[model samples]
Target: MAFDATRAGADATELDVLIVGAGLSGVDAAYRLQTECPDKCYAIVEARDAIGGTWDLFRYPGIRSDSDMSTLGFPFEPWDSDVSIADGDTIRQYIQNTAAKYGIDEQIRFGHRVTDANWNSEQACWFVTCQTAAGEQLFRCRFLHVCSGYYNYEAGYTPAFANRDAFGGEIIHPQHWPENLDVAGKRVVVIGSGATAITLIPSLVKDGAQVTMLQRSPTYVVNLPRRDAIAGKLRQVLPKRVAGSVTRWKNILLSMYFYQYARRKPDSTREKILHFARQQLGDAVDADVHFSPSYKPWDQRMCIAPNGDLFRALRKGRASIVTDHIEGFEAEGVRTRSGELLEADIIVTATGLNLQLFGGAELRLDGQPVDTGKRLIYKGMMLDGVPNMAFAFGYTNASWTLKCDLTAQYVCRLLQRMDKRGEAVCIPERHEGVEADDMVDLDSGYIQRAKGFLPQQGTKAPWRVHQNYVMDLAVTRFTKLDDGTMRFQAAPSRSASPTQTATQAA
Candidate 1:
């Protein structure tokens, strides 16, 4: 049976759990809470006035899933679409439909941008403050689950060009693409060599625009088919549920094998990746010049070109790539440092995102501001010394939802354990013999820009944040909950642990 908080005349001000953000992670958190922890009351508070988080926010042309939909889609409700590399609209609709079908949408409070959350240790609850259109509003909950992704929503990172104002035509960032802007019959110069630039080149060409991607350096690129052949075959014979499970696992294993292979033997993996790019490009473009990367494979994410669409656009002379630093923007276009002038009618800055944690909401423990970066993440969900709080962050190598789903399920287990123990407060405490490291190993631009703002992961198990799904599955599902790290206190005895006040962070 579906849990409807609104229909039961429950107090919206109080809840068993409070989830922030309505994106992929938020929706997953809500569904898991409803089914697994049916007795617990919860509601979703979305910063935006919509359901889809990333898919709803990003409206750039040719925006699609970087990974296959089979692995990216929620496991319980599998993606049935034939197109494995789905477009943004399809994903947005899928999320919306899921929320409506499960009555999760009815539990949402739209336009509620969470600002601050202060723990009330006496009550073993969190008073979460939100900024809304009407003004500020506060809600209290036993557990605070933040599903907001780690990127800043209000602004994207854009380096200051020497003469940005001098550009005569329209200059745009893919983050806030203007709906009325037309790209057809225009010479568009896109800056950056990341995933956004790769996806945009092909789409811009299809809209009758000649695009040239300008980058300071090259990035590794791979092509995958637009549709899944195995998915087609499986669905033809098997039931929908069985087919989805098989296909999801198949894709997951293949991706895991490739990622591990890249990590172990980078030289072999790099050459193999180049071979595919060379075959796709032929003599149309110099693979060594445009596709070669400076860093090792998997050091940063490899850009995916669906169906070799970006390559096709380059091979047919519909688009091009320039590997050079920019002197600055000119009236006509961007000028390269090499004395080459590339003119364009429009400019698209596909630079990257600015990483933000908890949707820029400040967290506090007993009225003292908690420095999130100073704390080590326990099991990649809860932070050290943060009681009854969990966050959803996804994988860097594979599809995001795979890790997010596991995180939500683990959170549910923690809630159940608290109930079983008759405890009102539960927190993970950092112990000795554990060293801290960067939250993620990747050196991507977004990750690099957020050195001090991001949290750290431990070097040992229980505290270590591994990217492998199989290992995560073993730990989150099979491991015992009372592993000696998570501390639970009955309501009468609940107080900020004495150890928490002394050494609570990294």
Candidate 2:
């Protein structure tokens, strides 16, 4: 895994499908394509030394999934673990196991950081440039699938504060959490109110740090336990598949009901959830100040785990919540707008990640550039007018794996449809009269942050992200495979002349 970054610079390699990441999405895509089209020449080029994607990168204390493992884990693989919520190490192990099970590890090229990719319209191929431990290398491929994920590979956003340079204490970003960095007994101030901040506060407090969660605004925080004992016990006694099915259904129904309630009865539902947080924390804390949010639930992201360890941590007095506007940074602490300075020996910016459009990688079709910002999403898989390329994006409301599973299945269907019709390429184009607003997804910072740079989907079927597995399965999995949205044309043979060739050489 030791990459010299100098050796790989020698030459460019040609591949039928050049995958730019080895993360869950990338690995999943490779798994699907390899199984479906075993003859296709493909390689997964990863920037890191090992696989596991996000699981490998995030190794902070108490790193675990926010959602239940049943839904979070891949569909083909059942997470047969008794525990409903899994920790970071377990998740990492699961990923490794899954990769090995599917023989995906061997195909992943570690330490392969993609620097640039330019699509050649005339050749119908992509010239990809990357840097590895060995050196820089170019890869030519007929198709490119960027599973780099939405988060910028670098650190998440950290606002410039006055006198930050003068501060001598340790500063860390969650994305770049060091293995040897110690927080034990240090006065730790975790800045941000998203899932990372919530997860880290309780974790660091257990490590003997006086943790304080600093937030600009309140987020909907629900307290749940780390394990669902009843569910675990049932799973232990009943068959794993049956138990998994039951648990999955329960979680899905509950999630759907909550989402429906939030959308239909926003005020009452918000009060109900806020009450739950207050009950968990008790009267010692200011519920109105720390838990109140201006927006409805799910309008922003909701943080949850099996049992609310964060609430327990707060109630135990190991951690405290500070909802205020940060003025700036002092030498040894954070200065608030109220003129109070909260001293911290270490500051962890657990701020949210910056969502990149198409994993921040550029896209082009033919000679003309295809700006994702200006495009529309076709069935949330392919972009309108982009030929022979498809993206894997999951559900925003439910577990990511479910939507991704559907996407993979749908891609297979699309490919099969093309093959049956003897089409060389299939492109889905949006109708002329479609309005812009219908395509816009005005939700959390994760989606809205790159609204323009992302492909737009309408509120109706195919475009709408229902998050309901049954609804999606009906549409994406079992719907008529041959849809009229896709245009088909015959593929010219390899010996075809320049004017007649349908595909460019990789």
Candidate 3:
């Protein structure tokens, strides 16, 4: 049931679990809570008016899933289409369908933006504050689950280029694409060589725009067919769910193998990727200058152009790639450091994302504030020293849903164990002398920029994020609940002196 704290007062409705965000992760969390912990009453508090998260938010030209839908889609729900990499609109519809099919939509409280979550040790409950359309509201819950994603939704990362304001043409960011921006028969210049730029160039070209991709440096790009034949064949003989499971595992293993191969045999893998790009472009362009990246393959994310669309556009003279630094924005277009002038009717800054954690919500334990930057992450889901909280952050090396599904299952298990043990408070204890490392081991601009804000990883098990989905599957699904690092305690009696911490061995 929905509660209006503004009209009904602060402590209006109490919930067993309170989930933040209505995206894929949030929906998955809600489904798990409803199924695994059926007795618990939970509500999803979405800041946005709609669901689908990144899929719904990104509406730029040719926006699609970088990962295959077999692994990216939910395990319970099979993607019926032959297209492995789906477009944004199709993915959005899939999410919406999933919510409706499971009746998860009814539990969502839209337009509720979580501003702060404070844990009361004495009461063993969290008082969650949100900024709603009506007014400020409060929610009380036994557990708090954050699935708000890792990037800022309001804006994309845009660098302040010199003389940007002097540009005569309209400058746009892919994050905030105008609904009716005309691009037909126009000269378009896209800034950045990442996934978004690659996806945009082909799309803009198809739309009758003569597009040019201007990049500071090259990123690894590979071409794969739009449809997966193996998945298609399996679907003919097997049930939808079975085929989906088979395809998902096959993709997961293959992705992991390729990532490992790239790490172990960087030079060969890089050569193979560049060779493939050359095959697609033929003699139209120099793959060495435009496709060869300075860094090794998988140093950052490798860009995949479905059905070689980007290469086809370049080969057909619909689009071109320029590897040069931008000196500044000229009145007509962009001026390069090499003194080359490129005129454009529109400039697109497909730069990157601005990473954010927990929707930038302030967290407090008891009466003291919690600084996530200083704390270590426990099992890649829970922050150390934070009680009754879990965040669904997915794997960087594979499809995001693969890791998030495991995380949801683990959280449900935890709740059930706590209930069985009659525990009201559970927290991960940080031991002294434990070495801390960077949260993510990526050299990408976004990850590097947000390092100070992300939670640190530890050197040992449970504290470190393996990033490998197979390894995490074992750790998250089968691991002991009462590990040595985690401490669980029952609620204190009214006449009791104070709260006490109890530690147990794994």
Candidate 4:
């Protein structure tokens, strides 16, 4: 039931829920909302012309997930395929299929970009304004769920090259991959060593391009096959719940182990990681020029996928890694700090995305600017003073969908509680001492670069994002829905408990 955007007409449409961004988060939100509250009216407003937000946007040579499909994918819907790490196309199809199966496809309006949303304190609704291909449209909804994601819709990241304009080679960003661009038999230099750069290198190599990864620093590189043979075997006989739990634990423990190893024994961890990378790359390649990094393990992000595709590509001589800081861009190549000019016909900047709070839009409460920097994130979902609004941001280290699932479940519980109490809104208050800007703990390049643009964490419960799934389960899933902070004024009989202000309690 695909939505016929042109046929919807220009009438002011109202819904119970107005979701921004038809990406993974938004799609998941719709699914959860529809499944739990079947009678609720909801519409997904996508800025893009199609569904699949990041998957559709990123069309680089080898775009794929960093985590295993079993964990990275949605919780309710299982990826019933042989490939553990799925490509963008497959992932897109899965989302589309999920939307269709849940009867949510018709709910999405393509080319509908949200311009602004002003919370009406008196009306108790969000007045959303948007620009669509049809015309200017307005949507009024009780809940404004933002799933636009942190990354900029346009070109994500740009490297600081002294002579970017002077570079005669075709410059390209992974986000805006050219449609007519051909890299076959061309010397390709990919800058940045994040997921995109590593993923691109392996695929470009197969496409007959001599790929060289120009990375300023190194990341802890590890390999697993595309499929867990042990897990696959167990899944054949066991139920989905048991199998998923087992696989989840396996990945969780491995991730925790590596995270701990990188933190506690960085030197040994670096030696082991580099040694494995060298072994994978083989002796024919120059290990000194490529595998070494200036920083310790986990100082930057680590890239991993099943089957060692990137490393294998390097071993086959189809690709090479160059660890050097780019001094500037020359007419035909990039000049490194070591006084070496690496010639390239094509340059791909996989420098990552620019982080934005609430999808880079300034939130307004009753026509006044809501500073997210000053506010505290409540349970990684709601913001203080903002009623009936919740956002879902996945974990950086582990599978994204895992955290999203928890957030969704928590949101559902909150919604159910609100409904039971006959409450029109649910606003979690922010506590004091947690308003400081420097609470988040991740040190990724993107996080460091755009720390000011992101939201800060609270010192106490609900505000802190403990990456441990078990602990998060207790806080997000099993926690009591009736927290004293949430007010239900619409109810005839108000609770007798003393109400605490946003500053007094969390």
Among these predictions, the greatest lDDT belongs to 1
Could you arrange the candidates by TM-score from highest to lowest? 3, 1, 4, 2
- Per-residue alpha-carbon lDDT of candidate 2 for residues 1-506, written as tens digits (9 for 90 to 100): 33222332224566767776776677778788788866567788888788777788888888888787878876566677767778988988887888889988888888788876665544445667777777777776656677776667666777676788766698888888888777788999999898889888877887889998899898888766667666687687888777777777777777778777888898998899888878888976787888898888888778873477888888878899899998889897999899888899898988677776555555655435678776677776677777666666666667777767677667766656655675556667676656544343336655666666766665454455555666877888777654666675555443222222224543
TM-scores for the candidates: 0.95, 0.89, 0.95, 0.90
Q: Write the number of the candidate with greater lDDT, choosing between 3 and 4.
A: 3
Residue 494 in candidate 1, Cα distance off native in Å: 9.7
| Candidate 4 Cα misplacement greater than 4 A, ranges | 1-12, 239-246, 286-289, 435-439, 491-506
Candidate 2 stretches with Cα past 4 Å from truth are 1-16, 118-127, 136-142, 438-443, 459-461, 495-506
Model 3, residue 315: C-alpha shift (Å)? 1.4
Query: What's the CA error at residue 47 for candidate 1, in Å?
Result: 0.7
Model 3 lDDT per residue over 126-171, tens place? 7788998889888878789999999999999999899999999999
* Model 4: lDDT of residue 221: 69
| Over 4 Å off, model 3 | 1-12, 494-506
lDDT at 364 for candidate 3?
Answer: 86
Worst 10 residues of 1 by lDDT: 3-12
lDDT, model 1, position 439: 90
Task: Show where candidate 1 strays beyond 4 Å.
Answer: 1-12, 493-506
Clashing pairs in 3: none
Global lDDT of each model?
0.89, 0.73, 0.87, 0.75
